[model samples]
Target: MKSNFKFFLAILSVVFVFTACNKYEEGPMLSVLTKKARLTGDWKVEKRISASGDVQLFQTNEVLKINKSGSFDIFVADSLTRFGTWAFAKEKEYVYFTYKKEGVDNIDEFKIIRLKNKELWMEDTEGVQFNYVPA
Candidate 1:
């Protein structure tokens, strides 16, 4: 009976550790892949939701590629539109990007709502949510 109680306690502890490790609002529960590995890929917007309603992007095609080297590229209609450096901020809760435009530097950030192997969800400062899938 003592051994059984010990086993139960061990299981409970394991469960707590895994659940506590999840940092995102929407979560994977547990992931073997590191954050950078999971984020390094080509992703396209699957949906966009704003305070008003769902929005349809004007571009026929748009892709955002995040590299393992901390660089990112945004392509619109098969044309390179933006290139930048990206990093995780605020304990990995936000994705921060820096780029140059008109010879000046610009910074943008997105709060991560969910991050998984196949799906990424982020919300902008304007309360717009973007859902991305592997492209």
Candidate 2:
């Protein structure tokens, strides 16, 4: 009876240690909120910087809408209308923006460096980082 009790206690201790270790287990981390359930919401572009070489601050209340189908729409708050339609291409490694009416090919393409907690950092060829916050 004494030997049997000690074996049961040892087994319980092992199980407790394993469960304790898994208690802190977490899921994968994502850079962007790619879920359609959460993406199809209103967002503001906030501010932009022209990173030609130096950081130039461009202030505007621009709004952006990202659809569930990887489609996007951008609007300038001044006119409160769409500036263009943006498509998420190349596994979201690149984005293509095209104006609806102007069609001037005012395309601004950049590589997404990071996305976390509604904050996105995009990098240009010149190594300039554009910080975007959801408005």
Candidate 3:
């Protein structure tokens, strides 16, 4: 009986550790893949929600490709629209993209809301939320 109680306590502790490790606001509870691995993929915009309660759904040919080597590319209708380098900031709570447009450097920071193997959700500084799915 004592050994059984100890085993139950061990399992409970493991469960607590997993639950406490979730860092995103919208979480998967647990994931075996690393954060980078989950973010590196071809993703298409599924929807966008503005701060004023406006929502837009996308059905166009747009894809965001994130590479494991810290590079990223945005393609529209098979044409490259933007290319940049991406990095995790603030202990992986945020993602920063640095790119150039017409000789002007621009950086966009996104706070990760949820990151899973097939889905990604992020919010910008303006409270606009973007949802992405594997493309």
Model 3 misplaced stretches (Cα beyond 4 Å)? none
Model 1 residue runs over 4 Å out of place are: 52-59
Q: Worst 10-residue stretch by lDDT in candidate 2?
A: 22-31
**Prediction-by-prediction clash tally:** 0, 2, 0
Would you list the rank order by lDDT, best first?
A: 3, 1, 2
Ten residues in sequence with the least summed lDDT for candidate 3: 25-34
Model 2 over residues 42-117: C-alpha lDDT tens digits?
5654444566555656465776766666566766764546555566556655556566556555666756555445
| TM-score, structure 1 vs. true | 0.92
**Better candidate by TM-score, 1 or 2:** 1
lDDT tens string, model 1, 1-135? 999999999999999999998899999888899888888899999888886887855333899999999999999878999999999999989998899999999989899999999999999989899989998
> Compared to the true structure, candidate 2 yields what TM-score?
0.50
Q: For all the candidates, what are their Cα RMSDs to the real structure?
A: 1.8, 8.9, 1.2
lDDT of each: 0.90, 0.57, 0.96
For each candidate in turn, the TM-score is 0.92, 0.50, 0.93
